[model samples]
Target: MSARQRNAAFQAFSWLPHDLRNDNAAVFAVRIKDLGAGVQTCLQLIETSELEREHIRFDGPPAEGDAADVPLLSVTDTSILLRLAITIAGVISEQAEQFCQASEDRLVKARSAATSTGVDHE
Candidate 1:
């Protein structure tokens, strides 16, 4: 999956449906911290074994002038803060929808397989 898809999957799995329904700084900060930990865990897993590290290469950090080195937002007004919150809420809502759809699809596939094999998946 692409980075965006991976991020969406992480968000979907990390936060509950109710958690993603809010978009305040405190909630966002917690989500950011959790995502950072998840990313670090994935990196550590990738580097765990010598064979995997040798075959799978990761690029170095971004250069000094890159966007990653810059902060994206600074809120000086309530209106701007409100807009930011709305945008975050929209993104999180979309991620939740995607998660729900994927879950339903998986459930359908599992049921189909169980029927074919004469097994009770429930």
Candidate 2:
């Protein structure tokens, strides 16, 4: 999937409660893969406490290389997967808003052009 799609999927999956963040959650093993390419990045959620465990990855497509073998997220560790996820979601949302703004601008320009040319828009 595209990075946008992957980001979207991650955002959707990350919204789950701490208890349901495991593989048993609605969307488990969410492999975003290659973010931009279709490379698969798998997520293996393990529960330890309200917030502590490993988000392991047995396979990470290829772009990730050996880093995929490492835990992608873990409250036990110092890495900020949860925080990163939130940041990614914010970035994705901003990008979406920008895309919508650009689209609306294009439509406005098109409408203006049509009016200037006396072309029927409807």
Give each model's whole-structure lDDT. 0.54, 0.45
| TM-scores for all predictions | 0.39, 0.43
lDDT of 2 at 97: 69
Best by TM-score: 2
Count of clashing residue pairs in every prediction: 0, 4
Task: Estimate, for each residue in 1-122, the C-alpha lDDT of model 1 and write its tens digit.
Answer: 35687567355544535545454444555665655555455444433443333333354445677655222222233335445555655666665676668679988999999999999978
Report the number of the highest-lDDT candidate.
Answer: 1
Off by over 4 Å in 1: 1-76
In candidate 2, which residue pairs clash?
Answer: 33-39, 33-40, 33-41, 34-39
Off by over 4 Å in 2: 1-79
lDDT of 2 at 28: 28
lDDT of candidate model 2 versus the reference? 0.45
Q: What shift in Å separates residue 4 of candidate 2 from its native position after superposition?
A: 28
lDDT at position 67, candidate 2: 41
